[model samples]
Target: SQQGEEDPQALSIQEGENATMNCSYKTSINNLQWYRQNSGRGLVHLILIRSNEREKHSGRLRVTLDTSKKSSSLLITASRAADTASYFCATDGLNYNQGGKLIFGQGTELSVKP
Candidate 1:
């Protein structure tokens, strides 16, 4: 599978702190996307940065892509208990002839203690 894998399967942090997670993918991709899920809820798109883009930000969230290594990193600032959730990284293949489906990584569970 050309899916990504996230590191630090679980993390614990205090409110107002920051959380960082890493992801590595198997193949080249046109773009990478980050998502967050609150428990049983569906995943919500947090940000999407194309291969041409090295970094992207959405509010307090920052994401960086490194195509050479087929990896990416996500940084979340000002943590809150409400921010506790599972974070996942996905990618759309680089080959134009390939299907456009997004492949998801095994997510990292974040716990923000208030």
Candidate 2:
């Protein structure tokens, strides 16, 4: 599958701490998007980084992509209990034969305790 695979399938952190997750994919991609999902809820888009861009940020979130290594990382700073959620990475590319649809990673489950 061309889907990305997230490392450290689960993570736990205290409030005010930082959390990081990693993802790796097998094929070339045009863009990668990160999404967050609360339990029993739909995903919310976090950020997107194009293949040409090395990094991007949104509020307390930071994302870095390395096309050469086919990997990406998401960092959340000063995390709160509200930030507890599952994070997913999705990619779009020639190998993603979903008719321009995205291929998603397994996802990383994050838990933040106050």
How far in Å is the alpha carbon of 18 misplaced in model 1? 0.6
User: 1-114, model 1: which lDDT tens digit per residue?
Assistant: 648989989999999999999999988788999999999999999999999999998999999999999999999999989999999999998777766889999999999999
Listed in order, each prediction's TM-score against the native is 0.94, 0.94
Q: Which candidate is the best by lDDT?
A: 2
lDDT for residue 42 in candidate 1, whole number 0-100: 99
Looking at model 1, which ten-residue stretch has the lowest summed lDDT?
A: 93-102
User: Which portions of model 1 miss their true places by more than 4 Å?
Assistant: 97-99
Give the clashing residue pairs of candidate 2, or none.
Answer: none
| lDDT scores of the candidates, listed in order | 0.93, 0.94
